[model samples]
Target: MKMVFRWYGTGNDTVTLKQIKQIPGVEGIVWALHDMPAGEEWPMDKILTYKEQADAYGLHLEVVESVNVHEDIKLGLPSRDAYIDNYKKTIEKLATVGVKTICYNFMPVFDWVRTELFKELEDGSTALFYEKAKVDSMDPGELVNRIANELDFTMPGWEPERLKLLAPLFEQYKQVSAEDLWRNLQYFLEQIIPTAERHGIQMAIHPDDPPWPIFGLPRIINSRESIRRLLQLVDSPCNGVTLCSGSLGANPDNDIVAMVHEFKGRIPFAHIRNVRVYDNGDFIETSHRTSDGTVDIAGIVRAYHETGFTGYARPDHGRHIWDEPCRPGYGLYDRALGIMYLWGVWDSMRAGEVAKRA
Candidate 1:
């Protein structure tokens, strides 16, 4: 697999390109036009600016973490047609700059819900955490305020502009059942997947964080079965899943290794991280080490190896470590350490294969 690192744009991130370039085996940056609002076509000049910066650091700008889905499209409104058209154009624009995969999610209202952004871990590090009790107790408005308060960097799904419409957005979705959400998603895929294919880009959907509905909202992309159905929606190579371990692993029942085998050709981007799930339905982002979290990092990697996956794989959210001033889970030291641990496993597997041939 081709290793990549997630790099928010200059001044938008605490981690620097020079620091990312130092990570061994990282050949690309999983990026996006973050400043571009949802449903708007990205500025061509801004896209070129990102390319120029990555090029200066000798990094490939191949995979974008998210080109967010507009709410109208997710709501299946009549206005959705306009947003879909905009998304199609965004796909074409990103393709022009060699972006191979556009990772996104269809979850309504919130992108990913977390009770704590900096929950202190046992080792003095902090991690993005989900407290089931707190989530159940708090309203969406309070949660939104908490998420936006003291945010060091961009939280993809927690965009303030989107959250500001919380009341109206929830009202719009009150009538939206899971089935309605699924239908809207299909409508979106049928319209845009072909465009993505034509542009040589894969439209990869990230799984619903926590793999469950939050605040009575519909979250359809949760389990293995849901993803199986999602692939069938468009049934094209360009339409695929991002195969996020932490998100899927929250359920404890998602067999991530099996998913690798099930959707082999479809997955063009992999967010390989770990999360420790508690019996209380809570979860926290953990290190890449298999023992640190519920997800089988080694098995997942070996499965990708067996598939001979050559797509972009990036170390996902990492804990705040070494007292580093970072954007919650987007800290550099732990994520860099995560890459080493992930590569160490993959390289060991490769060595074993080479020895067998010898």
Candidate 2:
């Protein structure tokens, strides 16, 4: 596996590329133009600026975490064609700069929802937490207010400009079922997959954050079966998955190892992280270590190794640790630690394989 780190960008993030390059096995940054709104063409100058910065530190900016899909596209609105055109242009621009994989999601509004940003663990480190009961019962406005109050960094899915119309957007999606979401996603894939293939960029769709619907919002890419269906939508190597462990792991039933074995070649990127699931149906993000959480991270790494995965993989959201105050989940300290943990596991697995062959 080719390990990469997710860096928001200079000024927008506290973690520098210098720091990221210091990580033993990290070779690149999984990045995007975070300040730009979805459906807008990313300025080539701005993309080159990031490229130059990363190159200065010997890091490749090849895997983009997200080129967020506009709600119009997800809703199948008439204006979606215009937005999709912008998306295609953005894809072309990314390809120009040597980006290999573009990670995007088709979730309606919120990218990922958490009732609490800093749910303190017993160990004193905090993590992004989702209280299922609270989320189920809390008023949507109250939840929004809570998220807005806690996070200083702009949360991925909760863009203020978009959330301002949350009520109406939710109303619009009321009639949109899971099947409708699947159809809309297929529509998006049909338009973009050919363009992506032409540009030599793989379109890697991230699974829904919790791998389940939230507040009645339809989430279709939540299971291995759904992923299989998604692959069938475009039926091209360019159409792929980001294969996020924490997201898919939230649903206990998802056989992530089976997914790795089944979709081995199609996954061009991966977000490997761990989460501790509670008996009450809630969960909080944790370190990448296998023992620290419910996810069998060690097994996951071995699976990747077994598949001979040479794709770009990054440590996903990590707990806030070591008094380092930054973006709640995107903090540098824990993520760097997470990287080393993953690398340790992968190296051991590789060594074991060599020994077995010998």
Task: Using lDDT, give the best candidate's number.
Answer: 2
Ten-residue segment with the worst summed lDDT in candidate 2? 150-159
Give the per-residue lDDT digits (tens) of candidate 1, residues 103-185: 99998978888988888888888899999998988888998888789686777888878988889999989999999999999
Reference-based TM-score, model 2: 0.98
Backbone clashes in model 2, listed as residue pairs: none
TM-score of each: 0.98, 0.98
Clashes of each: 0, 0
**lDDT of candidate 2?**
0.90
**Once all C-alphas are superposed, what RMSD does model 1 give against the true structure?**
0.9
Shift in Å, residue 276, candidate 2: 0.9
